[model samples]
Target: MAEALQPGDPAAIGPFRLTARLGAGGMGQVFLGESASGRRVAVKQVRPEIARDPGFRKRFRREVDLAMKAGGFWTAPVVAADPDAESPWVASQYVPGPALDEHIAAQGPMDEAAVRRLGAGLAEALDSFHRIGLVHRDLKPSNILLLDDGPRVIDFGISKAMEDGGGSALTSTGMVVGTPGFMSPEQALGAAVGPASDIFSLASVLVFAATGEPPFGHGASHALLFRVVHAPPRLDGVPPGLVTTLDKCLSKASEGRPSAHEVGAMLTETAAPAAGRPAAEVDAGGIPFDVRAPSPAPESAPTAPNPRAAGAPAQGTYIAPARRVPPPPPAVAPRIPVTPSAVHEFAVQDGGPAVFRRRIRKSALWTALITAVLCTSTALIGQLLAGVFLSVIAILVGFLPRLVGALPLLVRSSLRIDARVLQMRLGGTAFTVTWQDVALVSVSRTGNTLRLVVVLHSDAKRPVPAPLRRPGADDDREAEFLLISWNDQAVTSRAARLHATLAAAAGPAYRPPVRG
Candidate 1:
């Protein structure tokens, strides 16, 4: 419930008439106000002390800009603002719901489904903030409104545009500006923050919604900050399904945490269906909120004739005939293994037997040689001891590239195409792709570089070794391998052969590229 305006409160702010005091904070007083057109708004009048400061006025204007840029389903849209007023104030759409903290205190902790919905809604809101180059430096339970439809993120008081160097001079250096319990580790240590910091705060907020307690638990401001920076979150009562994703969100390293979009996807995928349906039904995407009472027993199953009926002529007469037994399922054929094909082979000039290998292109070798010659010539003209040091550096600069390019050839591995799997080994890492796991194998071109993208079935479980994992290839649905290139030349011929080999091995799972 909103508090009626006190005697000291102003009657009006700009054209909006103040009716009630919603709340007050360190920064200002929030009032329940009505516009001249009669629409309700929540107007936050900045404290006179803060308004008097030039730095605060600049930050207030920045906050208004950020709020204006963040109009979405889960964010309270900024309706108006008057930074030039004697006491600066900003008004936003009045969301008709209690703060998340207040709601949880009034009611008990939210169930798994409600918490998931909240996570998805808040993740989407954070995505909006990120898209517009803003980071909500202060995201906590009190900043989220628990509306009937979904959560609405409010209060951009401490938010900063990413391009504006995070915060104003007042918050620069050692000054920390976020709520203690909700601060990310980097924020707690006065380190630079980005969109990922908001994700960490979001995870904390979800923990609070699920268990009616912050992830770090309550403590002195400094203690809580230390826990946030060093201790693991106390997620004892959080739902198991949400724990994994939230754990990733709360990763100490910002890079380890999933982006807001990824978090939304993971939460939406794992969220339980609404109440009243069996768990299996929910998993299968069956009717949600199936609250109709169970059907009567008589209608649920067909009535079988009673064995004790009177005047039953014979065993087969009144008694239903024995149900026909289902025939045994057809036998499945065993998979036949084909001999591995050796399409290419290379032998070391030294004493090794012939082996299939990918060789470094001659152009790359020549380039390295040229670089080495240039470095050596530069070194010879330098001082005596410096020349010796520079010469060693020059030798390494030239040899490293050629050594790296040739390292794969030294690995004891084979690329085999057979009925059961496509096996390849480079260095110590091995990749085995079973036919059943293959969804699609195709070759694609980006500029001059050709790539072989192998998409796996959604249900497939093939673990890619750390060395084999590409930069963004940790996504479970697909893996990519770079095709061999010579100088700037396209490896069209080699890529075609590789594609054909993989397609033959993948059988029906292979998708051929469309001819243009």
Candidate 2:
């Protein structure tokens, strides 16, 4: 049993004065406190059960030591602590903001762009911690604060720091240190965790933000552990752009995940659209990673020199004639699926923006020929008795090529994405967006569903049109979007890869890739 902290009476620990109790948890009680200079802080005191364990105190002491050393935009700095005292306490800067849980509960789920920014920020924060050889074992929504300025991550190192210091683990012998719903599979199985474990926890936090629920729902801790270890996350409503990042992060094997920096880099690319194009589209539901290529920009527009190319390849630059075309008409956001096939080359057309067309390979032509021949023969046999049938068959033969060419254009143009000079063919029509045009990309999971979204470029005269099937018909349209009812994780993973590629292409303009 732990002694209760009373309100009103100040409890002095070392140089700080405890003012009021903040809250209590399985490990300890947190109190609102102040320093001699009146700086406010949140102080955590070890409970009697933990204090008797000697090892727990050491871990808390180590955490205090580490928090003092780790400082940045995301983590709360440590001010004072007393690990050797009768009741060990750790004090850190008091951040004024609602916990992520409360903020989402009060404000509703965040928009797609905001979630991407959050992921980038958190990943960068964790990267800083990992740089100094520290890992936060217990990362949860409650530990994250949505401050007026931005998000801040708290509870650094205390749980893991304790175990690192040869202290007792949060769980009983053979137990793990993380919360039931958010812990990685390895952590749940009493396996060793490194920086990858923190990445897993980060993905779990994103799940909560996107859908307001953890991947593993409330239940017995043991049951939750079993689920984390054996079953896939129930991602019923997550955005598609985010699925890949979250999936890789939540991989059961540590080796399967990327580092926190890699995740941050991808989110950063999604936040900032390349020049002259729109970012991905996002809505209340989720984020989309639809990268559409813009019309061929005028050749007179000076191309920025590639810094990477300076030292490596000596490929000659090709310059096309310049023409002052009218400002591009409102673009259409396409719902593209990121596929391994020649999506990149598909965005380019011979006529540039004047006439939108995709270059088909010989193989595609052969396949289309076989399909049309089969269809034409069937139609001729069925309608042979009608005089108009011959005319219709002749017309069909003439129009078959046009139909084949137009079908893919109509379908794919809607799913295109272009980040400035870096054109990406997502699906449907190939999209071309300048690097400066993209705003953000996000990933989320709800139950077993995953979603990804890209916020297109802001500051446009009119919103871009959604991808549509009928010519000149605007009402029935697909929003600038990407959807993968299944394998959504693969999409997010591909977006993350593209993000890295675009960021490298973007240079300094990429600017701290993640959003708040």
Candidate 3:
């Protein structure tokens, strides 16, 4: 990955002396260097053209600060830097292996186990970046180095720093910073890029490692961008054991993809994946127990970062939590049919449509019956005709909520989606929301249940379709519409799968599942 130092290249930078030309990139020229005490490093100096720009300088300094904060684990940590210098430069622990792109080109596709290791290493690196409130917006094969130990994630500072500062200084022509064929849908749309966005790109990288080509074919940037935003992933040659896992990772919606940690769990699950076993059947608690590091505090929000405010780590000794494999469900039944109204529109959608429905009619009917009978018996037994009439009226009033909810169940209630619309029939209500009108989709808390909801655009038509009311709705369904109670297995046995599916169909509308 390195060549002899060319003419005009600096012989020395601070204490480290340049040895060879590593490469040139979007940032600047990289050189192989060594410290006075003999520590080898990869030094990156800003391009003279961009180094003079005030904005790039600010970002360069932030990059230095960020690399320092992102102490080495599956990443190359900053060793020395001069962000304030004439041509600001920073050096990091030099990784000897070639970039993943180069390796794949020189060799061939890696074996499944190698790809698994790569995914796990990259996931850990991305996790570290995210925990520090950074999004590696530019995650291509070139940014990853293949090492005997693991893969190393690089170029974390430039574009994401531009995003955090509230603009795209590093990009032009209405484009967001990311490599074509690998960018997530939201990034293609220049929307909010979160940790899940990185997960989406991680899937692409894994696909490339296993297939020699990205999930989306490479060519003109426009074609790649359009395909990323509108097309389903091409997973033809992908390994069978990885197909299910990668499909979830390639979801268009950021929220639809698994978390980096979750992806790591899926890829690194080592139950031997017994012959014909499903790849998606993974243990959620499969984080590596051997690679010890401080577990970062949970994030408060999922959005772009601001370096000054990205929380400082709280001091503590962190241990990997004990693994708990979820028990298999007692029985798995075929999905209930979707209501005809919702079915027709989604029929054209690609295969494997998600159907969320349950048989709760009996329970709801019993509750209603019990209430009416109790109220009627007390009044009628007293022979007070007026009281009986009043009691009956009161019963009607009391049953309003239940009646509305029971109607759908009595009929055919379910939630269904396609690439274009989210059609839901719930609580005597039927409504649809298109992906264009969706501002974002999220999981929110209402009462004791976790709700999967669609947060709509301001001008989107209302009343939005929600099975029940969220706090700010004030009984008005227009705020954020709830589709299903995620906590209830009776609603649908596949909660995680459902969330990812909604996130995928929602496309750019998916947000991280934070119950607010």
Candidate 4:
């Protein structure tokens, strides 16, 4: 249940009228709100401090776009957003269910069937994110809502685009973006993350759902982070049938974990047989896996013979009919092209130069103002020489570097597409790739900025620029690179065409952004 709105909470945000407080976090407060049309929404208002940071605003807007792009069936659909507001905010459809954490706390651990359902639902949700280019960096129990239909994954606050420019400013060297107990090994190590990272976290969430205890157990954040990186998960009370699949999800290597689609199938298969039924009998049906209902027994199936029936010999042994075990399901092959298609060609260039220049100017102006204020304040305290020295130092240490860095924004970068090769020139650097060397191509749009991500086939390649680097590049074993990024409102109209063109060129390798 939501708590009544507090004294200081805003009565309204954008078009939504705030009525109650759903939750609060370090970055923001979530409120239960209602629109004039009677539609309910969960409005998240970022704290003033976080909203003030330009970098955080950029990340927040990017994440909001990703959240909006995510499929609505398994997630709290993003209904509206005002990232440019005084206190940046986003509103998603109001999910009328308790969080998984609250449900577990109030009702105790979930039973095997319930856990299976939860696993399937959450896996499907993650699959939706993976299909696009997003990863729910935080996938803890609290982030999941248990509804009558199924679980709904919420709180995409920390989600990063697997594509380019998805990293959050909150995470830096030695800092991480996820909860300790739920973090994957790579995440704990502050390494680059991918879809597999969410898979690892999903396994941890399943363990918690089954046993009511996080797989890593309880401790200080540092200790839990350490254990997540080095120790095997504790599955003391997890159901036997789920242990193998969960263990695979918790694998130290990201590639070792199963895909979300595969995990859904595994959970479905594992949950097929009714309680106490022989595994062999269940496998013999060759029925498509469905977690919601068990396959019905055939009409001609024979009942088990009763051993206690009257007979001439009291202790006579009777042999039961043998049951044939079905063959294991076919392995899910990695997304590789079965055959090459005809070479296609397309190209794109930075179309937002005017916007980029305006942004750079604003940033430079803010930096200069802040620097001047600091120096002037020092001088007002009767320290003229010190103020002058500090001002010069500040300009050299901060202003000059930022000004120099912004110079690249003026350079015209373009992506050239050929039948079998992808090439890009950003400022003074040039990156080239063969079609065979490309693993995945994904696109994401945040307001006016459009980002295209190109994942390489190997991790041995040198790191590329931030606009061209994959999210979590530090732990990027797949060597994913950013292909192109630009911030232009005019190009937004052509985004779909560009994305479709690229997808056609990349064929099966492209992972297009989710549209609805």
Question: By lDDT, who's the top model here?
Answer: 4
Estimate the TM-score of every prediction: 0.53, 0.51, 0.52, 0.54
Candidate 3 local lDDT, 1-516, one digit each (tens): 789988888999878999999887667888899998889998888878667766777766776787688875678888888978998888889887679987666555655555776788788888778877777777889989865445788765454642474655555434456787888888877776778888889999988888777887654464466568766777766768889999999987677788877887887765253234233222233433222222222364222222223454232211211112222334632122222332222111111113212324444465567656666776677755755565566556655554464443344445666656777665466777776787767765444244666666777766564443456665443433343342444334234435545544555466655445
The true-versus-predicted C-alpha distance at residue 235 of model 1, in Å, is: 0.8
Give the alpha carbon lDDT tens digit for every residue of 330-424 in model 2: 36422211223212222211233223233334434655565566566757778434535554554566545754644433333223333334333
User: Which runs of model 2 end up more than 4 angstroms from their true locations?
Assistant: 1-10, 161-172, 272-516
Q: What is the per-residue lDDT of model 1 for residues 1-516, given as tens digits with 9 covering 90 to 100?
A: 599889888999989999998886536889999998889999988878667766777777876887897898789999999988999989999988779887666544665666776787788889998998889888998888865455789887667778775456545634677888998989877778899999999999988888777987664455466557656787877878889999999998898999999998988776665455444222122212222222223443333333333443332111111122222434842232223332332111111222213233453465557656656676677645655565556547655565565564455544545557766565566788787887777767665455556777888877655655556875756655554444333355455445545543454566666667
The CA-based lDDT of model 4 is what? 0.70
Kindly indicate the candidate among 1 and 3 with the higher lDDT: 1
Greater-lDDT candidate between 1 and 4: 4
**Candidate 1 global Cα RMSD:** 21.8
**Candidate 4 residue 227 C-alpha distance from true site, Å:** 0.9
Order the numbered candidates by lDDT, best leading: 4, 1, 3, 2
Across residues 153-205, which tens digit of lDDT does each residue of candidate 4 receive?
99876677787554455665235778888989899777889999999999999
- Of candidates 3 and 2, the better by TM-score: 3
Report every candidate's CA lDDT. 0.68, 0.58, 0.64, 0.70
**lDDT value, residue 99 of candidate 3:** 90
- Model 3, 166: alpha-carbon shift in Å? 1.7
